[model samples]
Structure formats: structure tokens, C-alpha cells
Target: MSVRPIGTDDEALERAALRDRHLDRARTRGAVEDAERRHRAEKDAAAGEHGIHDVT
Candidate 1:
């Protein structure tokens, strides 16, 4: 195994915290995107558009 020194507790904790925060924001953004997709589908359907391949 490599002999690199282990990081301090605070440094590891900070990195983990940052990673968690980023993941949380990504999840939130994904949810918003899903809702937007649904809204767009409904709007398109109202206008007589069908299928994701509709280009007009």
C-alpha cells in the first residue's frame, strides 16, 4: 500500500461536508428539471403535439 500520510480529521470532514452539499444541490436541480419536463409535456399536449420527437 502507498505510504501517504492520512489527512487530519477536520480536513476529511470538510471535504465530506462539501461533497454532501454539492450532491444535495444536484438532487434539487434534478427535481426541478423533472418538473419542468412534465410542464412542457402538458403544454405541448395542449397544443396538439405528441411524442418527444415532435419538432413542430
Candidate 2:
């Protein structure tokens, strides 16, 4: 592999770490949204079984 200067290496490492953090946050947000959607659907289904319907 080609050798990079110390500063360049540090910059690259920092950028990679930042990118990873951003990706992790996005993944976590997507998971939470999915779980919320599923929970809402289940709650609505249960309400419907009791003859309740959401107006909004």
C-alpha cells in the first residue's frame, strides 16, 4: 500500500469514523421508525376488533 503523510492519515481516519457514526444513526432511526409503524398497526388492529376506528 502507498504511504500517506501523518496528517493525511489522521484526516482520513477521522472522516471514516464520522461517516460510520452517521451511517449508524441512520440505521438506528430506520429501525425505530419500523418498530413504531408495526406497533401503530397492531394497536389499530386491536382497536378495530373492538369496533373502534381512527378518524385521522
TM-score of each: 0.45, 0.46
lDDT of 2 by residue, 1-56 (tens): 99866677788999999999987897777975787889999999999999999988
Model 1 Cα lDDT, one tens digit per residue, 1-56: 88987898999999999999987887777975787889988888876754445566
Each candidate's number of clashing pairs is 0, 0
Q: Please provide the root mean square deviation of candidate 1 (C-alpha atoms, Å).
A: 8.6
Worst 10 residues of 2 by lDDT: 26-35
Q: Model 2 lDDT vs. the true structure?
A: 0.88
Clashing pairs in 2: none
Error of 1 at 48 (Å): 32
